[model samples]
Target: MRVLVQRVRSASVTVDGEVVGEIRPATQGLLALVGVTHEDDATKARRMAEKLWQLRILDDERSASDVSAPILVVSQFTLYANTDKGRRPSWNAAAPGPVAEPLVTEFTDALTALGATVQTGVFGADMQVHLVNDGPVTVLLEL
Candidate 1:
């Protein structure tokens, strides 16, 4: 499993012109673009979620786990896109929807289980996401 964690002042996802999920301002939060591969399992998914919670990227040098910040999770299989040898990116490293959807759900659930106020984008849906990146702070988490 892989997570691209971005600190955001606010974030939201829209599907078919309807807002599906959002995190309001005045609260510190992480926007997580999560990905999964065929070899990924629940254990690794849980570990990555735990790391995101414990990551000390917020002000006051506090981890999200310390303050229970909210999280916005979006399924992003493109994280595994490979463009090494061809003009077109290869998605071979990404798991198929049947294999990936459950892991995505698991990752989000793991974060929620860790006490995060977790929001999520619809899996396999065409989504428009908006965000105000705080400090432009971003981290890639893997396990």
Candidate 2:
């Protein structure tokens, strides 16, 4: 599993012009673009969730674990896109929808189980994500 974690002041997801999920931080929050590969399982999903919670990116020397900041998760298989060889990116590293959807759900559920206030984008849907990226702080997480 891989995630692009971005600190955000606020974030939202829209599908077909309807807002699906939205979050505004009291302080700071995270917008997670999550990806699932063929090898990713519940264990990897769980570990990544835990790591995101503990990551010390927030101010006041606090972690999301410390403040219980909200998280907005979006399924983003495109994270695995490989473009080294050609103009058309190869998606071979990404798991197809049937294989990936459940893992994405599991990842979000695991984060919720860990007490995160988790919001999500619709899996397999065309989504528009909007965010005010705090600090422009972005990090790639993998497990």
The alpha-carbon RMSD values of the candidates against the true structure, listed in the order shown, are 0.9, 0.8
User: Ten consecutive residues with minimal summed lDDT in candidate 1?
Assistant: 21-30
Model 1 agreement with the true structure over 97-118: per-residue lDDT tens digits: 9999999998889888889899
Candidate 2 lowest-lDDT run of ten: 56-65
lDDT of 2 by residue, 63-119 (tens): 788999999999999999999996999999999999889888888888999899999
lDDT of each: 0.91, 0.93
Each prediction's TM-score versus the true structure? 0.96, 0.97
Please give the distance, in angstroms, between residue 59's alpha carbon in candidate 1 and its true position after superposition: 0.9
Q: What is the lDDT of residue 125 in candidate 2?
A: 94
Candidate that would win on lDDT: 2
Q: lDDT of model 1 at residue 115?
A: 90
